[model samples]
Target: MENNNNLNNSEKKGIGRRDLIKGLAAVPVLGALAFSTSKKNAYDQNLKNSILRELNIDASTPPPTGPMAGDPVRLGIIGYGIRGKQLVKAAGFMARSEKEKLQKSALENPNDTRLKDFMEQENLNVRFTGVCDLFDVRAEEALDTVTTDDNKPKRFGTYQEMLASPDIDGVIIATPDHWHAPISIDAARAGKHVYVEKCMTHKVNETYELYDAVKTSGIVFQVGHQHRQTQSFVTARDVLRKNVLGHVSLVQACTNRNSDNGAWQYNIHEKASPETIDWQQFLGNAPQIPFNKEHFFRWRKWWEYGSGLAGDLLTHDYDRINCLFRMGIPKSATASGGIYTHKDGRDVPDVYHVVMEYPDFQMGTSQEKGKEKGFTFMYSATLGNQFGGRNTLLMGHDATLELLGNTITVHADPRSTRYKEMIKDKMIDPEVPLYSYNPMANGVDGVTSATAKYFANKGLLFTYRNGKRVDSTHLHIREWLSGIRNGTKVSCGIEEGFEEAISAHMTTLAFKLGRKIEWDADAKKIINVTEEEINQCDFITI
Candidate 1:
């Protein structure tokens, strides 16, 4: 009976890639499209256990309940900058069910914008215990905003002090890129769970160090690639697993936003100065320099402080694809482009392009059966142009999967043998999308302000579940907190974070050196590169 039920479920799922292969076994055209039956079973097993949990769907692992219920996880925030404040606010966000009430209230009282800011604090499973920042004003500002039990967050002079405090169960590290590895390593060593913002680390060596620390510490660690929680991505993964797009040969991703803030010209706080900031602490591993307000506010502009395009923007784009296709570090990477637009004394590129080679990886590649010619993952970013909106495309022989913010479109290729029957029957079109998943059904939001739209336009800012809007950050934070209690791994934990880190570092290193960089999977080092070659890159001053 159980076997019958399993068979019924599989049949109900309908005409997946494996089914197409078996159906078209006599046809020569379908030979290249056939994949191993084991692959489908593996995907099904993983989807049932892991991907479903990531999508906030019913999973075998129960959410923290009983003794764990209402026991708020004590969270310490290490950086009170833009991302820090966002994380703090997300911690206090109301669940989707309550958010529906707030939306209804907004419709009745149109003038009351405060309904949007309403957070059902009692329901929140995490509370801010301490806030730390090298900038005194920013730290205090963050503390003033976070309130639990009519309680204000205590300010810590440094992250080290906050890490030493027994009050903090976990630490959210939102500091500059260079500080990520150092703080995360220390936090892990101190046996504190971590939620580190992305780019993961400054350099390749520190990436390994941070991974090692997190692995040995036995604590929950979540990288800030919150897109892993986005429902469309989970849907896209299922679509990919079905082999609807056939063997994906190439992937193209872009980051295009022609705005001052988008280029990292963030408004410098008036209180920013040597008197109000720990300049030395902020410049820990970087070369010592006098306090510069521009560098303090717009740290993404420099190689000394940030990973520029590769780490700042490409990581977001790359991680989204990585989440869907589980493509680990590439075999080789080569990069181009330079600081063509925003020339505000920035050392890193304003526009960049990177091509990463995945030679051995076959999951998302064109490799058929035993053949082993890998696919290429290409990334392009420009701060000067928003001509083509930010998006990603996975090109396959049968179809192309296009992801544009909250929308996913599967366009069938004219040459596809798998879609031949559908095409001959006029079921599939060459121009129009064969399938589309739009989670947002309410067209343009009536209540959302202009500022909300701007931020939402950025990667994975918002997603939907069961046709109701959900905060990706809120879900991501809750996942981390739940994982801490239930001993379940997070969506973008150490393993996922490691892949993102290495991939970003590979692009950054290749671009900076003006050469091609190859990942030696066996030795875990860049092939044909020396310490001198690495040191020559501006970002690798250490």
Candidate 2:
């Protein structure tokens, strides 16, 4: 997990003033050179502003309360792709509102002029700091949206350059999957906290590297598994934990979409040109190939940059499932699927299913321990978007819980005849006291009857548990900020992020190898591979 920052110093030795001038000098000769040049300038200005904001030396005198309260932590965003842009909008809204509130409070009391001026300065306080991308245009575009009047962050043509900046307190990485690990590792080594997008790393082994670096760097880290923070999911977790559904054994989850665009057939922008896209940066550690707009914009379609639907969709399910069950990495994982619909030359599967097994565990010492039944997770995703519509079912011995959209329904196990009879008896039990006169006598039967009454009154034939759900989006972001401020471990820390990534990789392997692969969880290696077979396919890195 630790990074070698010193290596960055060595990398800087090669790019000098002449090299920079020569690079810029050749730009005009290239197609759409003017656009590239302007984009580059815009990125540079953005980086400069970001630097000022990081130091709290920008015009905004009094920073709004963040994790550090009086001393707000500066966040430098590295990519301005879709997710990065979204983060900027979110952070911008937060900063602007805080500034407005401070201004209003200052006006209420003339003695607050100092705070007023600070608010004015802070209004334009955030610095874009540093931007780097293989495509000069993407870096430029990211810079343009980040800069403000008082702050200008430095712009780097490459992520390596961004990490070299001393002003950055933390970096928000929304790069392609291939670039996620390297850039994050480099930033961590440079002593900057990291907030990486979902499916943290592309390679399985890279997960271990990230986990080690974060542990040693003493910097906060958060993974973009926002679903974990959702209120509905939280409510689901509570109901499951409370065993309202009895002994849970099987859990099924899925995400289905039925549109050309939904299936990642993204609309190719007519404006996309060499000047605005960073082709090289997008390529990162993936095998070098010709600059293709399709690959650059719709990366999830290819195996080089992404693990297809598994990483994009399945990983989210894995993270949430892990959270709900308090399970570690899956004991074993197997998958099957293919490109059944999309005829494009994409390397990823469109329809896929993966099954994870968690064998039973025992509680207490060996002599006194009792075995606890384990559970199976059946996960699936389809391109057709069938209308039985998408949903997750957590089935237990007592009842089954269904989560679809915002509504959650719990049903008594259809196979439980005995429980059904008991429920029916409770409904007719006139002897059942609304307020028990003899509390001691109203024992097991009273508790069971009361449970049935609670569900019956809600118009639910089966027992149901409901409540106001948590807003996962806010919770996930808050968790990240909190981790940064307190140096605490994040819910989706590096280890979990890595495991999720690894699980996705395994799915891809299963499809390609056309066989069920057994993973040695302890050794963290593919168990069934022979030496000769190993040389044929590159092993998955975390």
Candidate 3:
């Protein structure tokens, strides 16, 4: 999961001091030899030990989620598109033929460990007995690959039909952003637990409606923020809570994708047509239009379907930070960008920038209280060039925490209030990281493509659990199932979803309206804009 970027940093801090001081690794032969003869490495070892003891930082991961036992949880898949297949695979249910293909791939290329990892995944004891998709090809493929002698899944024509079935215990919804709220809302009303993908809702009303639906129905609802299961995030939360970073005044998260797939120019299936695809159902609340394969596959390019970088991409980075600090929607947001790249008749901007202000927010420690009262979140993205790919930077008074992939490195600030004495004594160098966490180190990790690498770097594709690489999506799905069967609370529940949706909507609205948008936290609504104005920026009318 980690690249050489950590070592190539200008400071050249050790990967992780604890890993070095404890001599926990053997691969670094010279370092191992040094550790073996402490007489030669006493100064290095003592220095690391002194820093570790002085910092007293906790890099340990939280306990693993409860075991998946008891009767298998009956499940249904609502979307069989790009993300749907990944979600299905993460749910510990892969097609036999697909498994064989991965197996053959591993044999051909020793580095291809996808099959090994998939096979080693601890079975969650789940059954995909119901499958629903508007596309005929995708639906049949799901059946063809997933159906076995013991489990014969039914194919439902519509999500409504699938929700009505008594056979399905819960639903995994990976449909388009617009459909997320509608399907999840109905599924909640149907008394089934729901796991829906990001951006939670397409429009303003649905966000509030879906929240009420999940709340009133008392269903275990989980938003698809799989990074909640990432241990580095847990460590980041710990770091912030422990005030290791001091007063964080600015947060920067970026999305730099330079490929067609990364820009959401997905391949249009040859089988897709009026007869093979459910065009009307796909359109749903969007304007009725003639069948277009481009619209169907590259929906992320349209404001009518996807929220572009704001809802589709920004939300991922937003939620990642939001979960760490538990910071809700910002007080105001300003944004400006255009389709500077990939000008392929798409309305959503390929280059986007949104800045959100949290005036009263204070996740800081040991500074002038009023000085660290406010913070700003800036999300900058460009689909043209991915210069120095996704790295989330949290700047603070005492230290700067860099989150790349599933790893974290905290560099001490020279003018730190918390670590001033250490800096003065030359015990902690501001140039090197004070602490580091890398669960993905020396592991059988793979990043196959630009988009996959992007997700992997964002801790979306995979994360380590108890030192073992586990599909974060799988753990997320299992947590949702546990909420249903074991009465456990889900991590990214309706409340979190509400904040994420509203924040993303506000960012998008700021771009669409070309003005700063303010939120009335007490009123729990945007103060300056009406729902109609907020939702009227749709690109497609026909």
Candidate 4:
């Protein structure tokens, strides 16, 4: 999902050779496209059809006229963990509000007996039929939270038992990363829609497996990369796409943390005893080790269960960047870092920097005429606190964009004379917000008298561009529901999840191989490997 603004700029320039050249020059050397017998045009057409079919309604239908109609989509949550609780809460709120509005409207119009009867017969609120977890306490807690008389959700011990129930319409998976693929595949096979968390799966091959299952099962599947749904990111993509900063050349995105907790050093609660924790269930496919409370709760520290900082933090950045650029997976990846700070027995790296290559799809040797260049993307993340904050930098051909948490700044590339002049003259309208001093303030104040007074008294100031602030949390959930309701194409769907996982795997490969790694995207494997060779050599496994 490239920014609409950026698309407009590409259109304005006609995606010229100059743009292609700029992109190719910056990308890493190991990254190169290998065109073969496969018809690229045909493949793209198939992808378009797949996207259209996934979203049940066609482009002509225009998103369910008036208000969202039909019986409230019955939903079944299969996990009672933090994320599971969040889904129930958010979905429940939306469902309740929508139902209230319909009922109120029906009551106000007394003549409309059909409308009144419809409200009574078709309950608009979601019917949470089932909740499941291995532990009875967790299952009961989840059931207690969803105690709505309009729709009382049943509780169960195992996911299989819950899936057997005819009442379930969909499943919200919030289990550990390792369980993500298995549970999602099972749910899809059982003919249920799935809203799986980010990094979609634990291993590289599992992504393909899950993708096939979802496609074959004809089910709605959404990966939980919530920021994709956020208004802020949407607005930023739009602003950048419009060439507000003039031809972006380079992008730098990072997530920083100083505290141990911020880096997944979760505190163990006193209640986290063997009685409350299901040791065998938590272990799942992971090696059968003795029950350790820390491993059960803060499993992110262990490579056996989690993809470390790369999957947790970097994946979010990758998903957001991909949406902004309208690009897919990189050709090659390289990374360097270590557990330099906390020596808490974590297997994965505590800090890391990775460079991903997006080869120039159009570039050709001087031998070929009418050829264009491609683009490159570079990203990094670390635990060490630096520059005193977090940010995402988008570098382009004419200008460079720096996007801090709630602010964005654009600077001209020193090499471009025209870009420099544009910057000097401020040819770009000042209507686009610029971050100056007093960075703590929220950037979206609508210029009211109270806001003016607050800024004047505190010497605090910021500007709001014609940008939409994204609520990543809300968007993530809404996108999941939309995928369920309309069978819409998910922004961070299976392909994206696979692409990100592969990128992370390649980073580990490059670090271990101690050389730049190349990939054969067509074969879906590293180019030099033999049939029997273990792909594990490319990953950092515990």
Candidate 5:
């Protein structure tokens, strides 16, 4: 309880920029020059110091140890909205100096009890190069928060200007769903690594464009499915790998929150207006509409910008299961639900459900090669009630695994084969969890907003590592930056993002067409639509 209190306080106070760059001052120019001799290494200490100096990071601060402590990466932020601000905060965690990090370690001398097992997760340190947003207020706010001492981020009138900037090594895209693919493609083509927020892409065709761009540019592209870093999902993946759960036959996931924010009724900024916001830029490829404060603030409520529950909520729940089980594209999907809760002028549904069929895939090597048993993946979401909270459950013959934020619980199945002997010997009981993994030894309760709590409980917002809570957003960003520096694939790379995008699109199509949609993996197209029917539909090309 005491540790959890410190956790909350640390979040509220935030880590200062001094703590972030203090350690870099100790690295000498000759030492950096010596390390730059390796052809495979991208770390240029002098160049990093110059960038830090420009950012107003004091050069006199002591240098601490880490992979890229002396060499920081230049980052430009695109779309400085809600999620973008949160991502920026997470990036700051990655920016903390190793010396400052060690000073807070649990073993050394924790200022709080929660510091145990906490070490600053390293990134190729990050320096904000610029910020881009359609809203002047949002852009200015983000620029101020992300900048250091006397350094101010260059304000870009458009995303293209930011992407074209030579000072930026990469860009983080947290724009609306529609702009993800286009901005990502542009960033890649501009020779910049990309960390793009989820929903992957808006139009189905653009998904392929973004995928191809990442491939062509050979850039490290990471989808913002930060849940990939959640310890519960990581443990669940191991459980699946161990074959202790037997063959998972059915998976259930849900998103339920009863709040104005959860329903996409975000508060409009007081400064929002035609003059303050570039409404034309925000419209992008969407149908042109006159500037309206509600439309600009509550964009997610409409289908023109957001993909409804399927893309916004379902994609999050589905991606975690996909990561755990390695479930690629589904065979077919059927969706049902409606805008039963929010009666506002929204085109998307407030309550939704989808069922996707998966072909028999090998869950274990022990299973017969020819034997196959198909399974169903289910996703349900509701904005009217916050009854059960959000979670993912995978049921198997041997046991059922329940995944919550930082917890993974496995309960025995009565008629299990693999666990039958243990059950009979009284080593395990069907009513009790056979195994449970909880990363948060000191629990956090009611420290955040209801909507934030909803996401946190679902392992989407933050995760625990080595008994200490760490922002998954930071971990995901670190992974992307590390991959770029090392020339390796990221956790949620282009192919993974493509798979997620296509799967979500299938659900969206199913809801839109009011019919089951089947995937023709070989042909790479939706099978149920005819050439004429495709033209008749207006949402997006399949």
Candidate 6:
């Protein structure tokens, strides 16, 4: 580690070699070292830290990934809205307007390292050959963003038209939830690799169709659960493997966003009209509604274009846990909640609660055999402060894990068998974290807006690798491109995506139908729920 640090010019701040090695003297593992509160009480912090130290991951070890030196992978982008723009930027391309905004911000405050971080982002050999967006303003802006001196990106009238073109090798599907499966299926059939956004499918049938299409296509497919690249999460997997948390019987993940932006009340652009936006193409298989700006701008608020909190936000929480431990589709799901907060004319629920049961699953127990078997995964969310809560908690018999964004903290249970001696001797406090992994311990990186803060906290924005700040989405895209270029395996492939989509869709159905939803893994169908019953759903039709 010292040898590597000596090779760099330690001139800059924040990400400098000397600055990065600030907190990693005693621990070395992906820059994430164990840390506790600075306020030292009566007992010494070192003694408390020594007894409960965990996360034995080798920080010096880098991921075995291939070099990106091949010919650029020709890519097409569909849907260039908020998420779409962010996705492209993560792939080493930022819009001129956003770049200028960052430049102004950096000029005002030296601490705003976003522009510097972006300029230093490693280039993944990929090119945008085509773009398909319903909005003309966004499409033209996307063309400007992707065009280069050697390669000029073309704007396609529709995704099918883009897929039919031989100029493209793969597609990035950032469209609404309803179009995720359709566009992905089209790309798969067109023999193009895909990097689609999360909540992979809007409906149950679409989920199956997508799974089948990707399987038959023989093309590289990757889902956009970018946090799969998070360093703390990678370490958390190791922690779970060592049974540091014992048998996690219950996991609770919450979302308590109060702001209008956090609640999906996005601003409607003034120039957004039928002339500027292709309203019909945007609708796709969704309900034929009279052109409404609210439905178009803030599509997440409606069930037609989005799947409410279950699909939009909960998928992140679900996939986060799923990635940590490959706990596939749950045996049963029970949901209950309603539109308690944002009472605008949207049909989808604002406050949501879902309980998914895994009857025959286990997370490797430290107790007697067969003692700890099944577990319940609970998801709760609200648009306001009434039912507000923070932190995604993994409650185990021996300890509890708090996954708040990029930081991971594990607390020993008071009656834990694994840490009973440490608790008895007062070497470890039940209230205090047994250990924690904070990658930002050396310095701080800040984000504005409640929504962006929420994502950054959840490790969706950026993470550090070998002391350098890196975007998780960029790593995700690079993994897809690597799979396309070098035949390497992708983390969030078809099977993982299937589980995420099915789990989310089941929870959504349970909430809508007011009953327990069960999945038959053997038959690969929703048990007790018929095709006709699923089709009759108003939200599904919408």
What do the candidate models score in CA lDDT, each in turn? 0.76, 0.61, 0.86, 0.60, 0.77, 0.85
Please report the candidate that would top TM-score against the real structure: 3
The model with the greater lDDT, 2 or 5, is 5
Q: What is residue 19's positional error in candidate 6, in angstroms?
A: 45
Tens-place lDDT per residue, model 4, 1-542, is 24433644645644556556667885644343324324676675665454334212211111211223456666777766656665665554323443465567557755423223223221234667788775566677777766676878887667777767788877888877778888888888999888887668876667778888988997777777665543334455655545444444456766566666666776675677778767888887787899798887778887678778777777777777776676666777777788888787888777878787766533222223433245555666666664434457775554455654434455545544333453465543233423221222444233223323222221122221223232234445555566666666567777777777677666656665566666777777765433233245423244
Q: Candidate 5: which stretches are off by over 4 Å?
A: 1-66, 93-124, 365-372, 442-446, 531-542
Where does candidate 6 clash, by residue pair?
Answer: 29-59, 30-59, 405-457, 405-458
lDDT of 1: 0.76
- The TM-score that candidate 6 achieves is 0.89
What are the RMSD figures for all models against the true structure? 14.6, 29.1, 11.6, 20.0, 19.0, 11.7
lDDT of 1 by residue, 1-542 (tens): 44433444655555655567677877865453455456777765764444234223211111222223657788898887878877776777333333566688778877534345334322456678898988887776677666646556688898899999998999988999999999999999999999999988888888889989999999989999877777677668877776677788889988777888778888998888899999989888887888899998899999898999899888988888888778788988999998899877898888899998887666532335654345789998888877655558988888898987667788889987676766776656778876677777664343344334434554367665555565677778777887888776588999989989888988887887778888888887778678777665534554
Return whichever of 2 and 4 wins on lDDT. Answer: 2
Candidate 5 per-residue C-alpha lDDT over 173-199 given as tens digits, one digit per residue, 9 for 90 to 100 = 998898898899999999999999889
Q: What is the lDDT of residue 393 in candidate 4?
A: 72
lDDT of 2: 0.61
lDDT of 2 by residue, 1-542 (tens): 12323344554545555556766987667757777888989886665454223222111111112453444456677776656755554444223444565578667755444233232222322345666555555556666656667667677767676677777777888877777888788888888888888778877667678878888998778787765544345555665554455566778977566677657776676767766676666776777787798998788888777777788878877776776676666666788887888878987888889887776521111111232366778888776564344467766665667764334566655443324554454421223211111111222211123322222221111111122222233345556666767555567787778778777766666666776666777787767655345333333322
Report the lDDT tens digits of candidate 3 across residue range 184-253.
9999999988999998988877888999998899888999999888888888888888888888999999
Model 5, global lDDT: 0.77
Question: Distance (Å) between predicted and true CA of 151, model 6?
Answer: 1.0
Collision pairs in model 3: 288-542
* Model 6: residue 132 alpha-carbon error in angstroms: 0.6
Instruction: Give candidate 1 regions above 4 Å deviation.
Output: 1-68, 93-122, 150-152, 364-373, 442-459, 536-542
| Number of the candidate with higher TM-score, 1 or 2 | 1
